[model samples]
Target: MEFAADVFPGGPSDPSVLTQYADHVAGSVWTGEERLELKLSSHGKKVHSLGRSVPAIEGLVIGTRLSPLIACSVDTGDQGLLSSFVERWHRETSSFHLPVGDVMITLDDVSSLLHLPMVGDLHVFQPLHMDDAVQMLVDLLMVSAEAARAETGQCRGLYVRLQWVRDIYKRRCHAGHWTAASREYLLHLLGCTLFANKSATNVHVVFLEALRDLRYVVHGISYTT
Candidate 1:
C-alpha cells in the first residue's frame, strides 16, 4: 500500500525531517481509544502502543524563499489511502497560510508548544531520514511566521527560524541576506529557487535565491486586522 505515488520517492530529496515524520503522523496505527497516537519506543525496535501496525508516512517540506512546496512520499500499494493522506497534508498547510482563525492541535486539554532549541533551532526530538530533517525545520518557521503576524498571537518563535536560515546561507558563502528576519528570509529563498536545478562554484542556486526573496517579498507583511 504505497502512500502517495505522486511524491516521487527520490530517497531523501529535500533533506528534511518533515519527510521522516510522515510515517508517524499519517500511518494507520490507532491508539487505545486515544485520538492522537503518542509515540512509544520498545524492545529494541519502534512498536505501536498496543501492537497495532500501520503503514509508514513520510514527507519533506522545504521553503523556497518565495513559495511553499510540500512533498510527501509513502511506501505502500494503496493509492486511495495515499491520496487521502496527501489531501489532508495539503489542507493543513494551506489553512496555516491563510489569514484567519486556526484550529490548533489539542490532546484532551493539553496542546503542543513551539519547541525551540537553546541556540534557537527548532529541535527535532525524534529520528528521521536525513532529507526529512531539513524540511521539518523549515516548515516550522513558516508555521511560526504565520502565528506571529496572525492578529494578536504569542508565537513569535518563527523569527528564530528565519534567522537560522539566513545564518546557514551566509556561512555557506552565499551573499549575506537582509537583516529584517521575515523580509530577509524571503529574499534569499526566492534567490535559491531560480537556480534550483543548477549551481555555480558550490552554492545551491535554487535554495539560495529562494531564501533571498522570501526575506522581503513574502506576503502582505501585516494582515491588516
Candidate 2:
C-alpha cells in the first residue's frame, strides 16, 4: 500500500493526520533483537596510547595548535535518548521539533564545543581514481605502491584502515622519522575525531593532502569540519 494511505487513510490535510503519523512512526520502531546495534567509539584510549608525553610528539601537536583536543573526551551518552531526538529531527527545517521548542546544533556550537576555528575555505573533494588514490597514499604515508594499492582495494579506493595509519606511526615516530610520524598521528587524529565514520575502522585518504604540511593542519580542520 502507499505509505501515506497506510499512515493516514483520510489524507494529510485531515485534522488527525499528525496524530496518525506519529502513531504510525512509533509502531514502526524496532524492538529487542530486531533493533539495529549502534556503534560508538570513545577514541580516548587510542589517543592516549599515542605517547603524547614524548617531547617530539608533544611539540608536533602544539605546533599544529591541536593541543586542546588531547584532553578532550567523548561520551556516547544514552542511545535511546539520542534515538528520540533523531525521530523529532525535521530535515525540511533542519531542527528538532521538540515538545519544548525547535532547536538545532549550529556552526557556532560546533566551533565552541570542539574549540576549532570556524572560518576558512571549505574543502571540496572530488571522485578519486584508484591509481591516483594509491599514488597519493604512497607519497604521503611513504608506503610501497603495491601495499597502498592493496589497502585501497579493501576500502573501495577512497579509504584505508585507521589501524594501518597507527602502524605507520609506530614505525616512524622516532628520532629519524618523527616528521612522518607526526603526519601519521595527525591523520589518525582527524579520522578518530572530525571525520569519524560509522564503520569506525576506516578513514578517507583524501585527508592525506591536508597533512602534507603541518602548518595547514588547523586551517584544514577549520574548513573540513
- Model 1 residue 159 lDDT score: 18
What root-mean-square deviation over C-alphas does model 1 reach?
20.7
Indicate the worst ten consecutive residues by lDDT in candidate 2: 24-33
Off by over 4 Å in 2: 1-27, 30-34, 51-53, 90-95, 222-225
Candidate 1 positional error at 127, Å: 27
Give a tens-digit lDDT track for model 2, residues 1-225. Answer: 123554344223343424444333333453222444544567766667764635666787687776666666577779887778666664445667677877887878766887766766766666677788888877877789998988888877589998888887887764457777777888787777777777778888888777778777776654332
Write the residue-wise lDDT of candidate 1 on 170-218 in tens digits: 4332332122333333333322322221221121212322222332322
TM-score of every candidate: 0.16, 0.76
The C-alpha stretches of model 1 lying farther than 4 A from their native spots are 1-209, 220-225
**Of the candidates shown, which would achieve the greatest TM-score relative to the real structure?**
2
